[model samples]
Target chain A: MSEELNVSCARPIGSEVDQGIDDSFVIEGAEASKAKKEETTMIMVGRKAPDFSAPGYHDGKFVNVKLSDFQGKWVVLCFYPGDFTFV
Target chain B: MSVDSMFVHKMWDEEELSKMVDGGIPFPMLSDAGGRVGTLYGVYDNEAGVETRGRFIIDPDGVIQGYEVLTPPVGRNVAESLRQLQAFQLIRAKKGAEATPSGWKPGKATLRPGPDLVGKVWEVWKVDQAFED
Candidate 1:
């Protein structure tokens, strides 16, 4: 990896989110509304899964797992309403 | 992930989920407090103050190949998830040389990619099955 490339903040191939040339996340008013509109639809197929890290429970143990840790492997990430309730 | 705390996840796994699944779901049940991660996945329900039920299948390269979202009352299908995973793995193994038909599962027919498959699928599915390797 070149120092210039690193400075540019370009993610490697097959992982392409957060790759703006300016490396800025701040959205202009109109773009914020457009981004919010995109968020509502949530059609995420054919896109990079967003990376995250959180405290988690697994096998009677509490641990922290980062979504990026599962990189280079298939993952089935599930989200439910709550722990106790079936809903 | 949901807005619930990790402590709540521990309680639910011990008190409820472990009984349902022998190993308590076999994966990390991450806490998404304040709907942070849930918001990223678009599963957080601001009106309801909770995250909705959803599942995402992500391939090795970090791409979101598929996802299913269900409301509070409805339940999602594990079989469908497994079928889709199998299909994705098969396609990857074949290097995209073959494709799975709708509702396709492991050990079933796989279609070859090309123009010849159009309108000839039903008869050709069996033909494709014969060529499976």
Candidate 2:
């Protein structure tokens, strides 16, 4: 994501309920908020990938893997949903 | 990788997933439980609360060369990914002087990208010379 838009800064979509607000207005507000969130997303191609460290399951053990650790080698980072599903 | 924990990955591999494959999954499946990497990669859907199908091809310098994000119903083609990696490797080896044409593979003719070859690619590239089985 872009440096300007921190995920932590995003508030819940429909958290605050306005007593006098019309239902359609609330829906429109939620949609607009979602669109704004989507706009802040960054394209990954041609950009330096964000460095990350996470626990990985490899060779029957949980190993700590970092993106920077594979700096000198080509890396294919494939992200799927959950395990044992259609993915 | 999945957002599940390492324990879940182990269980899925041993009990269910690996059985369907020949030798099981060869690559390391990283756990993004908190969706940190997914969020950074712009594949995490906050509303749906799941990571979309995303694949990234990063070069040796850690720069992303290509990426694709698909909806949940669509599955990515592994062969296509391998082909892209091979094409990138070939281009890098040639110092960006040559470019891979469509459906390019190893031992196939690479186009020397230049002003002359801009609009007349079909004239230079024959159907038989394009790809090899």
Candidate 3:
């Protein structure tokens, strides 16, 4: 018989956002215009990951989870878009 | 983890995702509702409003050992991730004395890092004789 591992899932405590928030700001004056730019920087390897504490879904339930909780274990953090959507 | 909420994750798991894997997703799916984590990882496309494909391999001590962020058109390889994880674990077990060569696997001969093995690795590491053990 195979033993099953019970993983805990945390749930967020608020409603989900329906749309993505625009982080850009516009200047009102004619000479104050600036080009719209999308700046992105890659997180370097061999550095500490940013700390995060959020709700996670697992095993038919929601639970509070944090990055620090996995201190002594290897963690593979993958971020993808929503389900049932094209990548 | 995904940007979708827990409810959405549950729905996806029940509807279609669970059948794709052997034992289902063993890891927790974090809900980054506001894209906070995605922005930190630098994979969030503000205009597209979604995180690009990103994979991070963190060690036991919480240091990021490896990471890859790809465009939306590409998918990641799970086999590579497993191989990297196993390689890291092996190096950790060996206390950093041994290093893995290209295409190295368990039971294969590992190279010992030193000045002596710098220019003459071929003498000690024959391709046909390395994996016999």
**Maximum-TM-score candidate:** 1
lDDT of all predictions: 0.72, 0.73, 0.72
Over the stretch B1-133, how does candidate 3's per-residue lDDT look in tens digits? 6678767877877777788875556777777776777886777777877778889999888788898888877888888889889998999899999998876777777899999898998887777663443
B-chain TM-score for every candidate: 0.87, 0.86, 0.87
| DockQ list for all candidates | 0.37, 0.32, 0.38
Which residue segments of model 2 deviate by more than 4 Å? A1-41, B126-133
True contacts kept of each: 0.76, 0.74, 0.73
Docking class of 1: acceptable
| Candidate 1 residue lDDT tens string, A1-87 | 001112123212111134232325778799887876575445469987876666666666666677777788999988888767755
User: What is the per-residue lDDT of model 1 for residues B4-91, given as tens digits with 9 covering 90 to 100?
Assistant: 7667777888888889887676777777777767777888898888888889999998889899888878878888798789889888
User: Which sequence of candidate numbers ranks them by DockQ, best first?
Assistant: 3, 1, 2
List model 3 lDDT by residue over A1-87, tens digit each. 111223437434322222222447644554332321122233678877766666766776666677777888999988886677765
Strongest candidate by lDDT = 2
lDDT of 2 by residue, B15-93 (tens): 8867887666676767777676687688877777778999999999888999888988889989889989999998989
- Which candidate leads in DockQ? 3
